[model samples]
Target: MSIRLDLARDSGLTLSDALSVLLPTPAQDLSDLPRTTELVQPFKPFHDHFAAQGFSSVDASDAPCGDVILFVPRAKAQARALVHHACQRASGKIVVDGVKTDGIDSLLKEVRKRVPVEGPISKAHGKIFWFAADADAFSDWALSDMTLAGGYRTVPGVFSSDGIDPASELLIAAMPDRPGARIADLGAGWGYLSSRLLEREGVHSIDLVEADHVALDCARHNISDPRARFHWADALNWAAPEPLDTVVMNPPFHTSRAADPALGRGFIAAAARSLAPSGQLWMVANRHLPYEAALEAHFTRFEELGGDARFKIFNATRPRRRAGAS
Candidate 1:
């Protein structure tokens, strides 16, 4: 990894400065750090880095802090909670790092407001900020009150945290009927689509697949259908244990800093793979995305179900045989 020393020096530093400087060292030195622990949230890129470090892992919510490292949530509010949580449980320093787009600056401000600490913060293409605090005094912000939407309280920084997404609204409006069978909502955000789908007749069970664990937690709480199941799995990489009768999604178009139309296209292909031979797929995306070709490539019949200038809903039915099956 390229060192953004210029930016790092500007942000402020504590134990995080030494660790960031030593990030490229041999794995043995990293693992050898006595009482070192690493934590990361649902973001794929962040998780990949933490995993590459080969640090012992734990679910962000349940991970405990001793005299160890702590990965805070990417969101500003959750990041604050993580700092407090670490301080509450551990006697040593806590290391918090995240990208700028995730709001590291705001997180630093929030942390300062809650507990005064002089730490290292760096800003460049993005930013990283880390501080040290007592785990015993660390707060559990998730347990605290937060603003709500559609009856769900968000910790901040999760996608579509403010309100229902207009694209999803269009997609949900175009959902087709599938009675008394298995259904899956890919990229399920706060259980909106699945919740609406369950209201239809003949819907037996719905699996809500969301990549962000916090989003999944809010979704599980938002929609209380006994048949609804939530899984924190990547949409492109995960396969269903059993084929789904219907797959509905508003798959993410961007992987990180830039828009990746391929990611959305990949979801189209993955949706096809996750379905039974005749299972139907319904999706909505921005009008600019060139997804029709991908949809047609994967499913036998692909057509625009609905849309406006900004978004379009597409319905594609899986083919009984492969392309050109004879």
Candidate 2:
């Protein structure tokens, strides 16, 4: 790949650099790496994948010393923070890589304003750039902890980082007066729903399942009650330890830039699989998403609770088994 060649030649990343890789995004064919390379990824799903591929992957940036190589995320604020952190932490060069769609060019320009940058080579719909990462430049780009209307803890790169998502708010507002004592908040970003559910009188436990480790980290800060259990996991793949009485979610519907409703459908299927026979799923989505057929495939009953022009919430029950399927 272009990133590999760029690192080997342009960035001067050597085998003995005590390398720490950051936020390595999901990919099918990762190149071979030196045995000492530490793959530092915050997202649970991608971390598991990279680990399974025999790479040394970790969930946090805990390395005592290493040269940092960060894949610039789509979030501009986060990318800046990554570069700044590497500059302060890495003993060797800090290499940055990203695609055009992710604003790599703009990132290069912004980094150049504060420090000397090198070799912004364009390739494979993206760019690769590197710098010496010294002298405390670009420190102010680090983002501070932020809050929404309800004082939920959030960071700039987390999903719906700026505030509580309107879809989740609508789902919460339209919720049944009483959700079951045992509830699961699938795709629970930053624990907004789980924290609110804990406020209900009879909620025995609220399981917050999210895929993004960064968002889950914020959730840990936002939720404090013993009743809230957190799992940094892919909602589509995580199974409930026991059958849950209720499932609640504002399921994510996209991974790439384009809208992919299939993601929401996977959450529906996972919810169906994790629930008791009589369990119900309380969920919300944008008004135009086509989750009705998937809901019909999984649940025998569907009721539209409430909505505005932008969002819709539903309560579905009686998990159904498809014909000729186990």
Candidate 3:
């Protein structure tokens, strides 16, 4: 995105007169832009990253701005919704930039059908283009909140937005009737597992830790239980407010299209750190993912709890101390 912006600048595209710019869904800082640029990022780690760099960051923005730079996300519905949102808030030019794999080509084609699109400078397996803001042009692309079975509220771009994940369903069935008292659901996307865990006999309280603010907002609406607590946090680093008697998770295994087992490993380490001395962990994952090593390193005993061919469940106990003094 930085490269595309630099090329655009050299090709006579300018933002000198723009008083303020809104960067929505930016994965990283575009340092060349003005220091006052505001970032609209929902993912907790990215929001925290920009906040620490002295930039004003928010989960969402409705305030009008001089200009807008939208970095497209992978979800097509989400990408179009952001464009519609940008048109509503941008008073000046709206710059759209994204990689081809993120459906930039398709989005550009859609935008051209609505308004006159400017230079589509291609670089880095992506394209960047701009157009004048016209709210009415993209009005039809506006996304509404999604409602799944059992009245679960979700939104575009959240994991399992369409319906309950089959893996989570499998995990729920495999969970004991009385897992524990205090529990933490790491990477608890939209609180499906947490809500079910609340129904279990021994569960007293549950912390729903998720990275996506949008999903967390859905969770807040979907669950009205007083026993539930929501935390917008990176599950890898999130500290449980109290020592947890059990940790249940369907930890995300990737940040991008490619699968990364390390993400799941981090969740395992976090669960180990958050658990009480005798705490147990109940987790589910794809059958092919190699998480046994991570589980062995973090706990004294672990075993497969049986799952269908597509998924696997694990039960682990006796968390181990890290290689350092308490």
Output the number of the TM-score-best candidate: 3
lDDT of 2 by residue, 192-277 (tens): 88887887777898889998888998999999999888998998889798889999999878777899999999998898888898
Tens-digit lDDT track of model 3 for 106-125? 99999999999998999989
| Decoy 1 TM-score against native | 0.77
Q: Provide the lDDT at 138 for model 1.
A: 43
Report lDDT per candidate: 0.65, 0.81, 0.87
Assess every candidate by TM-score: 0.77, 0.93, 0.95
TM-score of model number 3: 0.95
Which parts of model 2 are misplaced by more than 4 Å?
2-17, 321-326
- Model 1, stretches more than 4 Å misplaced? 1-36, 43-53, 61-74, 98-100, 109-116, 119-123, 126-130, 134-150, 177-180, 320-326
2 or 3, greater by TM-score: 3
lDDT of 2: 0.81
Clashes of 3: 0
Best by lDDT: 3
Error of 1 at 95 (Å): 3.4
Question: What order do candidates take by TM-score, descending?
Answer: 3, 2, 1
